[model samples]
Target: MSFSSVSPSPTNHHQMTEDEMTSENSLLADRLHAMLHQEFTSYPACPDYTSQADHSSTCSPHSRRAVVNDDWRRKICEWAFGVVDHFEYSREAVSLTMNYLDRYASYAQSKGMPLSRKSFQLAAVASLYLAIKLEGRNEQGQRLTISTLVELSRGLFSVELIEQMEREILTALRWKINPPTAAQFIYHLIKLFPVEGIYDVDAKRVCNGILETSRFFSELSVYQSSLAIEQRPSIIAYSCILNAMELVGPVTLPCDVRQAFLTRIAGITQLREDMMEVYNTRTSLRELHSAITDAECGLPGGSSSDANQGTYDTSMLASTRVSPVCVSGRQ
Candidate 1:
């Protein structure tokens, strides 16, 4: 009975007969409409409705139905930024992709391209995949794959046979995403401990190994076409990398995984030395940027937007895109 909850039913047509997938799709569309109904309905005629709590006073009859779909999309994104999102990075990345898509929607319109909210989501998921790949990791089969994403998008559109719509959306978004380099993630991570100077020893140590292992794993990647990339890794790769660092220098390690770490990290001779540089550079940059920004702190929206803008930008998000996916309840 709570909004956004569509109880699972066996005939989930996204898995069965997709054309018959109307009920669930309608529920999602309706949920979206409910969330952003005000924004959609109050356009043009209802200018002052935005200033009022009960927006119904100014919405036109014709505008109400059509805009409901758009409002529904806006609501979905709001929900995504709320509960259920796992990583701040993921949320930010997806949000940016959505905003770009919204802007591109205008472009698509100008170019006579048909783009629906569902098509846009596919592009966003594809962007997520490419971002992960550029960030130097990958997922298989069940995640972010083109076919799966297209199927996942089934419920976000209308029942009007949108086959060409999906194709057009894919055409508009020629698979591209901006990957934050390791240094970018590292710089941001270091800020969580914000005081700057020397990072915690273990944190510094693991970062070094992450870079080394990143290269090591990059080489190993050639053979991975045969590996099930989506297979849940034994431990999150970063956690595994941290444990690997315990193998280096004064740190102790289990003989086996330890030996593997040393072997893998050996690909880069300057491993420890690089850690020192990363630590120094991050520490110094943090101080420099902090000093510069602190003076600009109270300049209206400047500091606030500055705080929110990191590797990912989330300024124009219009909806939450829940994966029709139910991964293991693991965080």
Candidate 2:
């Protein structure tokens, strides 16, 4: 099938020919398909504790109690994001860190022995430290050292503790260190949108803004303990993108074009089969985005400025450390 073609935008100093566009789109479609398959295959089993409402509050193997409640987990997530931001690491590191953390928690809970708050904190630190090594680099392209991470823990944890916890986390996760992040899925799925018609200046800017806004939701999803634990990354990414479109597409896109884009995204993600799941997730994200907007602007009950109109400045969140790192047996 012949792919749709478009006039080159000024942003492209060199434009691809029709054949190049076709080949690139074909390659992207293949990668997207592969990712969709892989996302579901090795997905970590959600802890029984996460899904149940009444078993027991004790952190037992058969208990329905969560190893870490969402509020505490959210704080740790903020701290981890701060660590990555301070170290100039990619935000993807934060995503990987959380993946390790959630999966290990599930593993522990499944074994009838869940981690305590202090133990969970230690595990979180170790997971962040390990994820940095796997995903980050300094100005000199050097990975962060264990000693540095230990120091960042306010000397609460020793090098031995961090090292040992790293091994335990890796074992619990069965060394699946590279779980697909929602951000990875976002970039791939964005390519499925037809590039042919969005070359106009306003259209291009609005489209780019949609992707950026979607990325904001994807990052925020990392802070949501249940979203990633319950949903596949592909679904989360798709839902985020769709949410962004609902917020921005109507502003700049013609009705027909917006509908086409919506249709295209649904086809790419197979939204028909998972309509209810995606709808629920999108509703959650919409509420999340609304709450963030209100919180950012200090509004109580009314809508404030919309970050979806343009790119959101996440540097404030990156710099804010919510709480101290709790160490096991610390005063």
Please report, in order, the local distance difference test score of every candidate based on alpha carbons.
Answer: 0.33, 0.69
Candidate 2 on 156-264: residue-level lDDT in tens? 7899988899999988777878777889888887766654565443665666666776787888788766686777888788888877776643335455766676677
Candidate 2: pairs in clash: 61-112
Instruction: Write down the worst ten-residue block by lDDT for model 2.
Output: 297-306
Candidate number with greatest lDDT: 2
Off by over 4 Å in 2: 1-16, 48-55, 58-67, 139-142, 249-251, 272-274, 296-331
Q: Report the lDDT tens digits of candidate 1 across residue range 1-331.
A: 6586786577674556665455554554453334233223321011111112124324675544333134433343333333223222343333333333443354454565434444544444443433333333222222333343334445442323233443444464443223222222222222222122223344444444334433222212111211111111111122224422333443222235344433433332213323543344334333433443465421111132332221111222212334334111113
Question: Estimated TM-score per prediction?
Answer: 0.29, 0.80
